[model samples]
Target: MTRRFLFAPLIAVALFAACRPSPEPGAGGITQVATIDALLAGAYDGTVTLAELRRFGDFGIGTFHALDGEMILLDGVFYKVRGDGSVGEPPQSETTPFASVTHFRADVREELPAGLDLPALEARIDRLLPQANRFCAFRVRGEFRHVRVRSVPAQSKPYRPLVAVTRNQPMFTLQGVRGTLVGFRSPSFVKGVNVPGYHLHFLADDRRSGGHVLEFTAATSTLEADTLHDFLTIRLPAPGAAFEKVDLTPDRSGELEEAEKNPAVRD
Candidate 1:
């Protein structure tokens, strides 16, 4: 009788689960706003607001229109990390030229070992990946032995290519700190469309400082990963002179690498 009673509840639970609606497409996948090519080709015009971006996903990284500042999305809130190493919540009216976000349900959670530099951390994370071509989102939180981050100030009309804008970016390095690293790892096939490898942004525990992560050393960090297999959706800005006139035909991979990896514009 006890066995039959348990079986009855199991059947009822199965029926209830079967009746539940499937998750929507956006809820299950990554929603990318704009293209890396457009941003590279000097399209700093924001077409999506923070409010709209939030609706698609709550956790991700992206920059504001005109490449104003580094953007860090955490716990459903959007923050702007500036060149002066200041972090604040920008007005919701502000928009983003390029951003990638996911609803962030981690499929893998692990506690990584201590004393890993950027390359080592990447190599270790590489082993954890199930495949090379798939897109994945990563979030690591812990004490960083050293972290180099950079942020660019806003530009005016007649925007310059990302490479040029990065030339004047401000770099900051924090040592022996507690913080979180948020970013995405795109496949090599998406190179020109998005960063081919890991593109990460850092936010300190105090929430007072952050920027695009250039390098870092971690100590027993916790890593959470979410695989994005559903789709990558891109939203472009409306037809305008800014985006229409920009020349995107040239290959800017080398230039982008220089800018993103070692843009040391100031002393």
Candidate 2:
């Protein structure tokens, strides 16, 4: 009886193995089934929900303007949307309020008139190339969210906004020095102007060789649009260091002056 039972289990295992299909190979000995989106999504540790994507789309189109809000995630990292209409690094905090707009009407695909083409735009990300030798290459992926336009504000003279990019991810360098956060600003953008081209900001650590935490912050004018039909780029600084936090209250300048006078304060 025991022998018969053992034989029955062995037969079942053999039958299962025989029914399994072999994986097919593709060009260059690499599998071709993985899609660009899948490849992009796989780079992160978490999944990006549809609701979050919609909010991202709203922010991209300038429909969902928030003075202070948390960063949205596509996959696991914080994806920044600047005032000028560009995407930035993933956020470090899930609850931190970063300024953003929520209404965009442009398509973020290649060859789109809005100029936010993902593939083409990604190819233009040159700021980080210099650091490639220092750190391992990681895939940064995202998609555009489609949002309904509610209103459009009157066009103002175009100007550049101060943009800051911060490293929200921690990494250990080959040399073992800790990563430091850096920030920089863009040229400028007009108050109510809409431009055809999109600006972007990339974030990374100082590449010191140790593990370090980085964050991103941008202070720009609130998008003043009633209906949201216009497509605008979420402008961010090009590859640069992170920025220091500034008071967002109406008396921000006064606070800065006070801080400057304090001996403990450092620029």
Candidate 3:
């Protein structure tokens, strides 16, 4: 018997904040609200390092270290250190290394009021584990943000499980890629059975067979006997990359294909 669980439609809400068109230097001499693209370009221009890139999230409100070991507040604005050691708008893109900061913003943000129960959200997601385990293949579609998984099942023992991921989610920002989870296997085997705390780490790629791959990991853990495990993390490669499935055994070079019949469960 097949069991399915679905999540409630996510309601999109907008937050209202005081609008300031220009940057204002605060007491600490930090510029607030820099463009997303400019921040990335500055990092790429050698003013910032990959290590810095990994520290900041999409929100862009955090503290980062400069070359001189001083802590600077990254208020999401482009700034330049002057000859007098003061901060100001660095040279513009045409004159300097970066052209403009990219406009990247999150689709939704909300502050849960104090005393709001967060465990309820976790409970709701735990109920959907069975549904996520049903599919085993996926593809990246239009806009580089849509991920589609095949609805068919594999014909072999120890069925493979797959998950498709879109670029609009937080996982995309963390991994810097647009792809899907492929070649997942459960430690416990029963066709269509949901195994708690079992997951596989695979590479995310556009195609199931060829391209650059990034490590994607997923797992389910039991909160209680009735509550199922929820997905922990999923990663994919940068946009436009392709990936092909390969065998995971000793040879690790053969193409991946669906089995004719399900294989016996592992002990």
Per-prediction CA RMSD (Å): 8.6, 22.0, 21.9
Regarding TM-score, does 1 or 2 come out ahead?
1
Ranking by lDDT: 1, 2, 3
Best by TM-score: 1
**Every model's TM-score:** 0.87, 0.20, 0.16
- Model 2: residue 100 alpha-carbon error in angstroms: 1.6
Instruction: Report every candidate's CA lDDT.
Output: 0.84, 0.24, 0.21
Model 3: worst 10 consecutive residues (lDDT sum): 252-261
**Candidate 2, residue 189: how far the Cα is off, in Å:** 5.3
Ranking by TM-score: 1, 2, 3
Per-residue alpha-carbon lDDT of candidate 1 for residues 1-267, written as tens digits (9 for 90 to 100): 899998998999889876975354367677878778778878888889998888778889989988889999987889999768899999989999989888888999999888877777678678998577888888999999889999999888778788888877898888888999998888898877788888999999998888999888897699998887778877666776366666778788887787678544322
Q: Write the per-residue lDDT of candidate 3 for residues 70-127, one digit (tens) a residue.
A: 1111223333222122333332221221111111222222222222121332233334
The segments of candidate 3 whose C-alpha lies over 4 angstroms from its true place after superposition are 1-77, 80-87, 93-102, 112-267
Would you give me the overall lDDT of model 2?
0.24
Error of 1 at 90 (Å): 1.1
